[model samples]
Target: MSPIPVELAVDAASAVAANGSPRKTFFGHPRGLSTLFMTEMWERFSFYGMRALLVLYLVAPHDKGGLGLNAATGAAIYSVYNAMVYLLALPGGWISDRLWGARKTVLVGGVIIMTGHFLLAVPASVSFFVGLGFIAVGSGLLKANISTMVGHLYPDKNDPRRDGGFTIFYMGINLGAFAAPLVIGTVGQSSLGYHFGFALAGVGMALGLTNYVLGSRNLSAKSSVVSSPMSRAERTSMLRKGLFWLALAVAFFGAVALAGHLTVGWVTWTLTVVGLIIPVIVFARIRRDKDLSTDERGKLTGYIWFFVAAAIFWMIYDQSGSTLSLFAQNNTSSKLFGFNFPSTWFQSLNPLYIMALAPVMAWLWVALHRRDKNPSTAVKFGIGLALIGLSFGVMMLAMAAASGGVLVTPLWLALVYLVQTVGELTLSPVGLSVTTKLAPKKYASQMMGIWFLAVTAGDCVAAVLQQVMGDAFLSTTSFAIQGAAALLAGVAMVLYRRKVRALMGDVH
Candidate 1:
């Protein structure tokens, strides 16, 4: 894809007067896209920085400067927290489209996240939970809307750079994610390292927020162009409704979090209830939407299937945050040439691969297009799931090599990451673009919210996977179970690829 030209930047502002799409150029890509890219890069740095420390810190001995939570508790908390973060994207997407506009919503989210990090910097137990709350809410707002802004950058789906644009945007995500664990995780896990890491994450977020503020003019013009005027009463009504729902969501999640300790029955019931509500609501809504044609309805049904398949993939995949990280620390020998690499450092591998491979994927698509051999996005997604499944099996094989109960070599985990990165390249960015493409135009942002919901559900299910393993670490049993599950799910996705493609119709 060609970079945006200098002349386009001048023309963009000029065209604004005529109420048309603006043109811009800086890095072969539009300045607006770059602005979003930089903002996301720093935000992810802060987020992943905290994440890299979370599991390790919880399991580390208090004497070693950690929280000292048991593995199950830590995994559960991590899963719920991450789930809520993505779940919040639903409201985040709604507000961006209906009320605050994407720019303002992102700014608000950044501030909330920064505040959460600052609270985390405080060492008290009280502050820990408070900080987590802020982070979840803030992430919910920022995560989904930022991607939506990228779609707004291109007026048409046919633009060749659309895929490249999403790839560039995804690179920003990996850039921050790649750096966080190496930098922030190092500080937080050390003696006095935890506070330092938390502080650093906060600083990163502050920088991101600052960037967003400064770049607002360059980034938000698209939102400004489409924004409709809201009356005072409508604004008030929206605020009232939003606050009510926010309060309710918090209470509901809070109850569930607390209920986990009450009884197994309560937790099980809550999960069952939450799971049933979605399908019920979706079915009723579909029955009511008279405006949809048969094809559109079929498309929606395909999305639901994708969500199910994606949830299964993510449930097995998200173990990197907890189960996988623990394996690296306790079960894998990191020594290479007499130097032991930190377990947290392993977290960086996937992002590093992403950084390295994104350009290749972009180029491959271009090359394939030139040859008229381009595969459908559906094919790519299926391939992605299969690769992820294969990655876990790679880890299982590594465990098999440790049949004597000795720590496995670190190279095994390295290979696992390599495979996972290849899988991510196939699915993650493509899925984001697919949401934009397959969605009905009327509910573009809302459909994105639904997509995020699938991701959040996967994260929540990951907790179950972690709990089922229960301190087993890299045991052969645990490895086989998780690996077989991931592998089988991936295979199923591949087999169902034809049906998924037919539902997607002509989406390229």
Candidate 2:
């Protein structure tokens, strides 16, 4: 797409800044904020919409227009899919920095994602796997770059409005997440074939792309520039190497599929190993970089701590899709006020709570910051872990009450999600903001990708934990163990707060 005219760009930025701060436009932020807000809202609608239906579609009987996979296998597929989505971000970010600029990468990623969803809307089995692969790669590209663009919008790292801008941006994420299950879940799980729901997700992505294209002008100019452009010789050599590996990967997977060895378990275990290795390699590279100053290295150390803490939190949080999702479907009573709701709809609760609570939390942060009483990011991470543990504790209680074949009330799960939402509010947005702050300028997007790898590691761990524990996930024993572990981790973080703060140098 053509860049926005310089005169118009200048005019728009000036008009948005008329209130003395550019941060004060479009609901007290830049005009570009509205563009990103809507674009992400729709993108999330597509992503979460597909997620709500994924496991359900997998486990449903073939006659019922589903794959009919067993629960364990289905969960494995879900985990692997999620792991790949975030895992590919490492290369996605690298490509954006070195070759395609963020703008072009996002555009290409959107089209690829939309294509993936549309392919899934087809009823064939081969289409299903291909579609998933497409979406995973596409999301890896879009997710980190879009977020990096949001940070780019406010050039100043210490811009007082930065956190608030991120929170507002987060609201867009939750908005899409909130509506996905309600709209897509209802349609997809209803009498309309599951593929129909998949189609709707594609439509949502198309709208997002359209919105992005129209508002491309409002985006910062830097977003369109390749951060580290390559020379012609370097580009040619890199392309050849990438193509060779791409061909090798396709052949290897094709061989596995033809040999009937591409089971869900195989995919899960393979990616899990790769996921674990990637972060270690990235961290080691960062640590050994001679270009990094002492303070930068120190901040890098602090980021690693935050990374570990966030990964642990996601291990518990991501169960919402796998173990928690199954629990809602099979163990919780869906009836309320004489109407039986779809179990998939329960997936909406976390985002719903986030939508309601995000503004309050955002306001709370700013209010506290003004008084110089805002909690440090490390403290917020601790609070997040504690809240997650408490949520599981509540779940354990519900499990006990529902022992002996009685289904627990759906309200119990909702309550769990409510508390978890508070924990999410405390950690997620803060994690994103701090990642931007702590990263060296040369590795900004890659660091964001590393942040997402935490989710990948967590998802992989959750899948393995669920499989090993088996029915324990449905019992109080498992809940108790998880709850206690999280609580202890939270306490540990709180104790280490001072040391981590010191490692962070001047970063707040």
Candidate 3:
């Protein structure tokens, strides 16, 4: 899950790719698209590169150049870090609109991200946590704005080519994701050590920054100008609000420390509470909007169901970097063809599977659509949930196969990733497509923030689930529990799909 939700900035349509000097279209798109595509490709390379190693490095023994933390602690950190990245997108968008424009924000964010990775190259606990913080904040600033910049490439919001262009750009993201684990995992999990692997991630960000500079000429100047410059009164209020929150955070941490509850696990759960609350507040505010009609209210009700379903789906799917990565290391064998590979290489499977499977699924759906027989959105989500749940059930079988204490074959995990990819194909695109249409027009821009919050919420609950599993985290019971939750949700969706569709109004 290299960031969910396809809601990029739609308002930047006024900022088309700078057309001049008799330019050519890229794959029938604006020439500037190539620049953005590559920049994003390298940026994603940086992101997924570090993520693949995060939990593994944490739990690895210090003698092996690792932190030696337990699985619960490591997974907790990983989940909250991921949750925070998506959580920050709300403010990231606000910063883009009010302070620096997207272009500057993205550039600064890239530099901060690069600094974070470089800090990660240093092998110290303090550096490790600080590096994670920098990456989260920097990604917050960069990820949202960079994705939004894609919308700037198309001159018209409804341009026939816009969807195709977004599809292609998305492929660039997957390309980087697919390649990262193989490269970073090999180095980090190998004799050269984890720090070197992290350094390589820094180099990847440097390459992304280099690409941005090379492509700067073709970028949107419209992003260089703030759309809604904040008034002085608003600025004063924002400053006061920021100070109040900052002081509150300091006091909260101080109280936690005085209460003898200041620890990684405790902090992680606290952040989880914040992550869970954000979407609730956002949804409540949106529901209270006076502009929404009765029809819009109906769609909003349906969207809530889909949101819950999406959150559950992501809770399982996005565990690849945390629990699944550990399973690959501690439970699954790394041997293949007389050579042992890095367990982290398993991280590459989802994106690679996505690249290979997406088109096949697309063709299948479009073919069915031609006959007007494609599954409804609710059914698609149901099918996706079942597939992912079945994939975890397969892992239960793998655990049974490894009952003799012999590590299971990588193929078992591969089978799981492949099945999950199929499920992803079934649900993910439909989720994005439906989200844009489900929201009221007044809140269209805010929809991206809310949509991504689904991932944030999922990651938060994942932290909760993983922490509560105790020693069973790696056992068949854990698999059964996770698989059953999804299966029950899928069955419910199937049983009530018609009602779900009806609540969606005309959004089919």
Task: Give the Cα lDDT of each candidate.
Answer: 0.74, 0.83, 0.85
Using lDDT, rank the candidates from best to worst.
3, 2, 1
Model 1 agreement with the true structure over 316-339: per-residue lDDT tens digits: 667787777887877788788799
Give candidate 1 misplaced runs (Cα > 4 Å).
1-25, 28-34, 150-168, 224-288, 365-378, 402-405, 472-474
- TM-score, cand. 2 vs. native: 0.88
RMSD to native for every prediction? 4.9, 5.1, 3.5
Please tell me which predicted candidate would have the highest lDDT against the true structure.
3
For model 2 the local lDDT of residue 51 reads 91
Worst 10 residues of 1 by lDDT: 1-10
- Candidate 3 residue lDDT tens string, 1-508: 4223232332333335456344455766766678878888888888998999999898888898989988987887898899999888878888998989999889888898999999999978889888999999998898788878888876567876677778778888999998999998888888899999999999999998998888888876776778778999999999999999999999988998999998777878888899999899988988888889998988998999889888988888888898789888888899977788888889899998887777778788888999999988888989989988898899889888878678888999999999988898888888877899997988887787788899899999988877787556777888888989998998889899999889998888
Candidate 1 whole-model C-alpha lDDT, 0 to 1: 0.74
TM-score, one value per model: 0.84, 0.88, 0.93
Model 3, runs deviating above 4 Å: 1-21, 158-160, 258-260
Which scores greater on TM-score, model 1 or model 2? 2
Error of 2 at 477 (Å): 2.8
Cα deviation of 223, candidate 2, in Å: 3.4
Per model, state how many residue pairs clash: 7, 1, 0
Best-fitting candidate, scored by TM-score? 3
